[model samples]
Target chain A: MEKVILIKYGEIYLKGKNRKFFEKTLENNIKNALNEFNCVVSRIPGRYEVSGFDPKFSSKILSAVGKIAGVFSFSLASVVDSELEQIENISIVETEDLDGTFKVVTNRADKTFLKSSMEISRHIGGLILSKNKSLSVDIHEPEHILNIDVRENKKTYVYVSSNDHKGIGGMPVCSSGHGLILLSGGIDSPVAFFMMNKRGVKLHAIHFHSFPYTSNLAKEKVLDLAKILAPFNGGEIGVYLCNVAKVQEAVHENCNPDYMITILRRAMFKIAERLSKDKNYSMIVTGENLGQVASQTIESMTVVENVVESTPILRPLVAFDKTEIIDIARRIDTFETSIKPFEDCCTVFLPDSPVTKPRLEKVVFEEAKIDLEKIIDEAYAGIERIIIKS
Target chain B: MIYLDNAATTQCLDGVVDVMNNYLKHDYFNASSVYAPAVKVRRDVENARNELLDMVFASNHKLLFVSCATEANNTIFESATLRSGDKIIVSAGEHPSVFECAKQFQNNGVEVCVVDLLPSGEIDEEDFARKMDRRVKLVSVMMVSNETGAVNNIKRICKIAKKVNPRVLVATDGVQAFGKIDVCVDDLGVDFFVMSAHKIHGPKGIGALVYRKDIHISPLLWGGGQENGLRSGTENVAGIMGFFEAAKLSMKNQKSNFEKVQKIRDEFIDEFQNSGVKFSVNGNGSPFILSLSFDGIRGEVLLHALEEHEILVSTGSACSSKHSDNRILSAMGKSQAEVLGNVRISFNAHDAYDVKNIVKIFASTIEKLKG
Candidate 1:
């Protein structure tokens, strides 16, 4: 018997006519995740099987595959010829360390193998019980279930389905179209990136930094967040950094101080839209939650997105509460890096009280006070693209 | 580029780098091994230790090399045999390494007395004397205020503590004072002294804790019994050699370097005064570091503005820059505006930058930021 890993999918089965396309994308994603490991991932009839890897690297391989989206469940099992004695021997070995009530489950894909599914299970269960002398059969809520898959490839695979080996159930990355994330070195944007990545959106990021007002460390912190999210996006992410210090300086000098964040955000969306068009991204993703901050209010968001007329602005985290967003951030391992205290562009010329509900006409009037279009063009012209490789 | 953040760290001298490279590339022998080359390396380490001890006039004390000043300071607290009822004293202006340790001990039910800081950034000697008692087991303070470069009278503090309780251990973190000033641990009367290499022109990751020979402190790490079983790990042979070279050069030119730094400091201050900016010197102590407080401008914004001209400065101690509140400045009773506007510009003894340009950039940046 040869040791192998079995991968299962969830949402792709419902794709109907687009199943082939999604399956191909998932296979490529799995390959990318496990690119460092020497192994072969082969697509069988209903699942994918990974073989020819060193036994010492089994756990490492399993962990890398577990992070890929669309993988419903996966298991490390041993494959043998479609024969009863071989299956029974492996099942007995699989239950050698068990001491509680157990059950044997058999899936007979090759009906011509002669023994019925129940017959094979009964034979395997009796043999495991006879050798171990410590197990009893419990079909309902068994402590351990020894799963047997007799496939149409004339091979039977045996593995114990562990509840711990669960996958992150979502569509595979790159299944959806590309978008640009307005990533800030804050708690929300990286989490927004993660949410969209889980929904199969291939996302690049644009960060606005006000150096000499903000610091280089803030830019680095946002880049670090992008690096942390790279693994979920096939092991690399491209981030663009635009210095909005002049834009901020102009607003701080000319406009009312309270509209600093409002006007600054409008500048950011304009730059993001320009870069997205230049790079062929169809949407602009943000982590702007409703009423989380002054600039994130429904009215404030309305004023911010009014500048981006060409592409759709997606706020995946618009309805999530702060605590719920933090929960996902912690789960995705971006919470710790996200909370690093560095001043972002928004905090550069922050006023004492920002306008929670901004009128679109007043914001446009403020925008007219400064040469915003020229400043934004200059900011976009100085964009620094950093590729964080996996 | 002009580097005025010497109090945070200094660039290593070319000669020190050569010595370190020799040890790292050729004489890479484990000091604990029983081979002839290893014996030679151990002998070299001992010689360097003696030389460093002589530099501080601490031949009567035993020195234990550690990772850095932070580790040495932490080791001092970790080796203290204090219990619930025992009392320790630390200054409010102490570095976070010493101040935080005292706070943690207080959390574990130790009686911690924090002496206040005078407006000149010096430790309040009267308050320190008042806090001294027979119940105090340890007295910890820093030799210099890293925030304002105020040199404390460690000899007097040590005498006061010992007179109150002869058994009390006196430790001083001399990271900012060792090579910058004339450091004589013996004359200072400190029972335990901490020093780092990088503050001078030595390599990072090497510091030494010198203690009186008769006093015995327990080990924080137990491994291969290196450093007299106190700090048990492979000896940092290259770093130790580099530290010895840096200390040697620093002492050789200490008197002349002091005069040079004082001259530059006077020029910089004179130029700032002539530039017509209304500013106050936070603490009037050591000429090596100057802390200036502008009334309405933020120190952080000013620091970044100066960077536009390739001049590096710090708003506070590098360790406390990320923290909005400056504990040292606050302990000196400065107001919130003064604390927020304070900037620290330090000078190395071997500095070779033009002082006029720095002040010009400083004044212009402040003017622009104010506007």
Candidate 2:
């Protein structure tokens, strides 16, 4: 018997008029995700079924489909003829091992099928009860749910469950717009990247790595975290590595030691804003959660946010707590890579105690100590572009 | 670049590399196949194992080459057939592989006890005597301390342990001792001993566990029958060959190289003292390893300072540097400031020729850093 996965998505169904466009993007993404497995992906109303791939790779396809943002869940299913007897037999086999009270949900997409959804559920439930004496029927709350999807094209997919893959359900990538994330190698930033991508923002990231201060291992760690989020974008993560040594040197030489992080973050925003303008990105996203760290406080974020003149700043994690960010990071599989202990550019010269309530006026005054234009121009000359393959 | 982190790992020798490259280029057959070509590869694997055995002079004990010293340590520690509440003792300064595994056994209801080390960084016999009881099932101590390079009296420890509890099985991690010093499993009377090839100028991923032939060990990795069913995986043919060649070379040059490196190590300490720096050595550790600490400068900062001059060094054990504080060094009673300033300068035979020149750069780097 041939086997396949029947995938269903949530939220996209509520788009109404633009549902077609969202479905098209999602289907293309699912196909791209499983392109290496040689599967035939066919779309129907409210669902898509993957077939022609080897049954051995069903679990592989299931995991791949689970990563895309539009995915609600997927199931390993067997394709059978639409006869009620065929459906009855498959349903019996699917729920034979399940115990306690159970429920059978039958969705009839085929109008010409001989039985109503109620009749089909009753017949299949009777067959299952007779075969397994250990089970009782419970429509309200059941220990196991055997789902039956009866489609129009003389095909029925019978499975014991539905939508097992709980993904970041929002919208499809590239469906909303394009933006850039200041991808720092930390737990919060990668989760922010995943959250923004879930909102349909196609993203390219940029990082500043200082060689003498930060090791190459630190850079490798950032690229690794990006790769974990690459599948959701349907390709590799695009990153631009900028060397800001001259900027850092200028700050250390001229700026106050306590203002190191404050000035350093300002320099990053200045560079990011210029790059955003050149790339035509509509906005900038950061992993800043309110009061989570010294730089993430209201006073600090406002100062950093003010450096970028016009591009809107999005802090997806602003309302989230550290555990919530970590939870999302763990769900996206980027948590482990993010926790790797390597020095990022900002961490190399971390102050003993940074200003928690950093006044913008005072920060602006500290900025006057360094030659801003010369540092920016010299640092911009050292920008390096690195393409991270999935 | 000048690499001084030999205690962490070493560059694979050209001879080992040539052997590995030859295996990669032409010999691609699985050793388990019944074909003649495959049988020849199996012979090569056995030849490698025998060569390793010869280097350790443990013909009576069974030697199985596994993957790295960590695996070898785990295999030996798990071989002990101890029930819940049984006592097992390990030195406080054991490598993470042995120390961590022993601690985990406590979760499974085994009574895990740690014996402290002497101020000189040697295993404290008084503490061991106090810890070891009649119910102790196993005892593990490294042959040489990886952090301090202190030569552990494994022979004496095992002798004392067996005298106290005749049924106690003793195992030692021989990673730091295998190439730098002479190792004979039979002479040591240790039931189990482990060594890694990388520490001895071989590959990074291959190591061996030599144990008494009568003991039975549980296999962690199970698949098609391999390594006499103790470890079941495709024989890492290239890695095994690399390990074999590296072991052979180390055995041939162990004595002369040890003496030559020892001279340079002494000179390094002498020159540093002559530079008039307020510093002190950690302990009378191994001659190959020189652990020195400056007064106020952090080891990591000094490590980078030397790196600026194209030199590489490590601060304490490289494995534990990032994850946590050096528990072994801390347990030896080194203060916080001392621990932070502790830098390890381990020597290699190849680097011994330029010892004076490297020491000169090191002294200047310190002055530049402190000036």
Candidate 3:
């Protein structure tokens, strides 16, 4: 009484040339799913078989395998060695109660098998109908169908039906290169990180904390955000906190108050770009929504863009409204921590009336007054790195 | 490190940890089991219940354990509205669990009315009184707001609700106020009260709902007849014991703790005032929680700045922090930028040392940013 669970791949079969990749993926998925079942999963030619388990665990293993993503369907089957006399006996036993219209589906992958697929199907169908007087031969609308699959390795699998489940399948996080996220302990950045993770991009978060200007709760909020992002990225997320108060102070003393945000954003970009380059990240992800604030305006954006020479800046939520962003944040569970009233560095040195739109020439004129590189270097020097675990 | 996010969850006291560890290691038993060890666990649970009842001055009320304040709130609202057409009136500043649960009644044809909050984050008492009509079946208000820390006049509101319709039940979400302030359920004359263990230095997954003895409500879960047949699941004996110990500790040192934290809050506020920082306190109510808005700086930026100093505070209630629009602050009519720059600093009785460090760090950061 050798019992085996026969499993079939669903959508993976649709891939023509890349079928092997899909098959391998599905095989791995099934193996992982059946890991707790303590069964040996062996790959046969057209399908896979689960063996060496208690016969009673067959139904449970089949149901579990069917639910894994990349798996199309599965069935509980009986495995028998390739022997003509044994096949005939097993077929007789399997078709004893086939008291209805019947059809036989056979796959003869094993060329060594003397019986052809058509010959096997016809013989099995006739034998099943002869056993029960009420059964009629209906090739199309068969009430019950028997399946006989022969593999190249001289083995035969007989099963009735296959069952299917959904999966959270995409590329694993970090499969794509990493990106540095300007996580601002607010709703948008964490949501942005979540969005990026969904697309398989791993993240490293950088938080700008203005101690003495903002409370430690603000920093904790960023850390909390990092922690929330951790599980999705498969483990710990690296977080770097930079003290921007000194830079902001230098900018306020050396530059115009209205240009404070512009100067600060440029400095942040410089540091992020430098770190991104250092950490081998291809881009930077920010929570900046266009026109959401003075610094987020087109002019301000252009001014800030002028500072970053390397790495493309990815603003995933640039077009999304606050409501839309918040909705996503709520769905991802970051809305709660984002709504906490922790002040970040951007709030610490905010000018009462920041330039929502400023001429490029005027921005350049203002930039000339401050030691831009020095400020960024100073802020970069104060960077405190914390690796967050999932 | 300074921790001013007590409203989100507090650090446990040594006594709470000791009590919880003792229960976890030595008294771990299934209360429903017939063994003597189980019986002892049941007795301890009952003893803790009686102590809590006495502390709240609600010996007559029935206390039921829940996972958290969210579960407690959901159970009450869901049970109360089991009958169709029951009207639920809630404050606009109510916690999401309460507000959302009340809103859900709309699907069952139960009318939900939201009472507005004043600019000070206090409920408009007159407005609430006017809204209390014969159709209202329940009035749910939070005793102290998790975000603004505005203490509502629960006694006054309950009185008004009862005056309009004696059958109108009053439920108070006391997650923020329970341990920090003295909450005498009978003194306030509420029909139901909810509190979370984590908010008062206990474990995360335990909370309680104290229902008036005579209030008729249906059970949410159908299982073994546990929690007086309200919530039916195996008791989290360890969490409950920890909660009791934390509650006891909070009650014992609440006054001195309050005074100590209040001084730090005042000092922090004074620095902002002296620095000519253009800011406004969200609610002019309790000193336990401070919602400060600094003009020019985004709240997130300030949050990161403070993070550099190893200080931990929040922008609002941790639950609602991830959203950009501060519904609590916005309900009080704060401008978009004003709401964006707002930060919440909550203190517990045990946070004096941390509070001083927080104030010093905050002052210096502001000075640096101001330069």
Candidate 4:
């Protein structure tokens, strides 16, 4: 008895003229994914064949391939000679316990074979019926349909309906580029990070923490956020933690409470823009929702935007409501960590009656009171780069 | 430094900020109130709505503002599928909001058919035709491909869909394409068109769904009858104002900005090609999105490497970034290596100068990797 595995390409079939390139790439990817199986993988026309593996590892290999990006669906099929007698014999033996309504669906690629598709189906169908008296053929509605395929390699493969799980078949990562996510240990930011990542954006994270003002728990929450984001980002997060506590504290001490958030936002933008410039980030992604909070007000947003010389800020959750943002955060497993009662630098000096609608002129006036450049420099000085390995 | 990911979200325009500031300071009143401040708020709301109508080129379309695109999408799905056993057909690739909402009908025994996509990421005509039958109560597709930047032939698809099932409502998730592209619901002939303010440089927490007057949809949220009873909640007046301004600006600069970004995209592609790097573009759908697949290096690795140089790109869609699945690239038949190596370099009109620098960085990084 020869054991064979049938592999199917998911999104590769849609590649049209460039199908072969993708197929080859998928083949290589499958081999790499199944490297531990010690199996021989061979491309056989429409499908690839995996043989000579420890039967014990066959399911594992298939499971791994199922997780591979380019693979659509796969199955372990029984490979037999193209001869009708052999196929019939195998079908009879395989369906010995079958007591349900069954039909044979056959695909004959070898035209030279004497039997037609319908005739083969009838013959195979009759053989199964003869083996089990309780089984009846229902052409339109069969309880189980045995699928048989004949290939040009002078081989026929038959399989039962068992293993067909959907693959997350999209374009591979690095097929796009990288995105720098402004990760706050808040619900909205991580959800925003996940949303952008779903579209195939490789992610690097920027975290703002005030060391003395905010606890290490805040940093730990962010690190946990990174770890949660790591699997999707290929197992690591490049975190740039800027301690804006001092600068924020300075703004709180010097500026009016209403202007504190606006000034602090400007400083954040300065740091984000500088980091974006240094990182060549195409855009800065934030978790800000419009009108969700005082700082996210259009007026405050403008003040923050004015500080950044370049780098478009990507606020994926900008238009999302609190409930929607929280829903996604919960879905992405970030809600628990985000709700851990850790106050970030942005929250430490938060005024009780923070201005909902801060005037741009007032913000500018308060901003003028502080040496913005020096504050930015101090914030940059407090920057810490940490690599999180998940 | 240049910011190019405007289609993702835009900075708040100065005028929008001023308007919001004035409203927040002196006229902060709930629109539902009949009192002096409330009357002022109501007038402002009406003014903003009218302004938005003019901005999007939809003066007559019924506009219902929601929290965001996701809520708008959910509203359409929940409302349109009120009839039992109604079928819905959605494009294979839509924003998660639209796609996930369409999947909800499946649980309700409402037949859901996801139309196939062409290699260019457009809706497959044959597949669309095949999926369109009497059972299909509504057909929803996106105005643009968020991942590939592929602008869907909404006008054509809508035409075909209406031809097949005149009763079928046509909805488009215009989140990515609204401001970036010329979005006139009347011109596109879509029964429902959704737009998110944040995508167009407006504030977040505000989006609108424009429903054709003839089409009726149920309200997803039940609250104070705001947004013509289609959406009920405290209106996000500031966000809406910002959205209107952003929409207006995007409309005003659409052509020039598109051309500018096209030039940058061309330069980046040309430079990458000239550098002799083992790279391939994932989708030939739209110039707004450029997905490049590099050999050997994983996207995360290159992402961090480029981060070291202050270059930010994306691996795929930002939504699925945290998940190990690269559905778009994988759907494009990208291998693990290729999928892992994929990065998206999206640009807006303001991104003209960034491309040149990006080209240089891309060349140097590829060279470094090769060395």
Among the numbered candidates, top lDDT falls to 1
List of chain A TM-scores, every candidate: 0.95, 0.95, 0.63, 0.70
Encode model 1's per-residue lDDT on A211-298: one tens digit a residue: 8787665776787788768888777899998999999899989999999999999989999998889899989999999988899889
lDDT of 1 by residue, B1-371 (tens): 88989888899999999999999999999876645577678768877887788678773577899989888888888777889999999999899889888888899999999999999999999999999999999999898888898889999999889868889999999998887788877668788899999988999999999988767668888898787677899999999999999988988988888888888888878988998887888876677888988879999988888888899999989988999888888899999999999899999977687777778888888888889
When sorted by lDDT, best at the front, the candidate numbers are 1, 2, 3, 4
Q: What number of backbone clashes does candidate 2 have, counting pairs of residues 3 or more apart or in separate chains?
A: 1
Q: DockQ of all candidates, in order?
A: 0.01, 0.01, 0.01, 0.01
Off by over 4 Å in 2: B1-19, B22-371
Between candidates 1 and 4, the TM-score winner: 1
Residue-pair clash count for candidate 3: 56
Where is the poorest 10-residue window by lDDT in model 2 chain B? B53-62
Residue B337 shift from truth in candidate 4, angstroms? 4.2
Docking class of 3: incorrect
DockQ score for model 2: 0.01
Interface RMSD of each: 26.6, 23.3, 25.2, 23.8
For candidate 2, write residues A20-43 as lDDT tens digits.
Answer: 999999888888888888889999
Per model, the share of native interface contacts recovered reads 0.00, 0.00, 0.00, 0.00
- Model 1's CAPRI class is incorrect
Cα lDDT tens digits for candidate 4, B1-371: 44434445567767767767766776777776544566566656766665666455553365777888889888888768546588888888787888778777678787788887776667787889888887788888988887778778898888788867878888999887766666666557788888888776678888888876556678877787666566788887777767777777777888887777777778888888777778887766556778788987777677767777877666666766666667766655567887877777777664336555677787788668667
DockQ of 1: 0.01
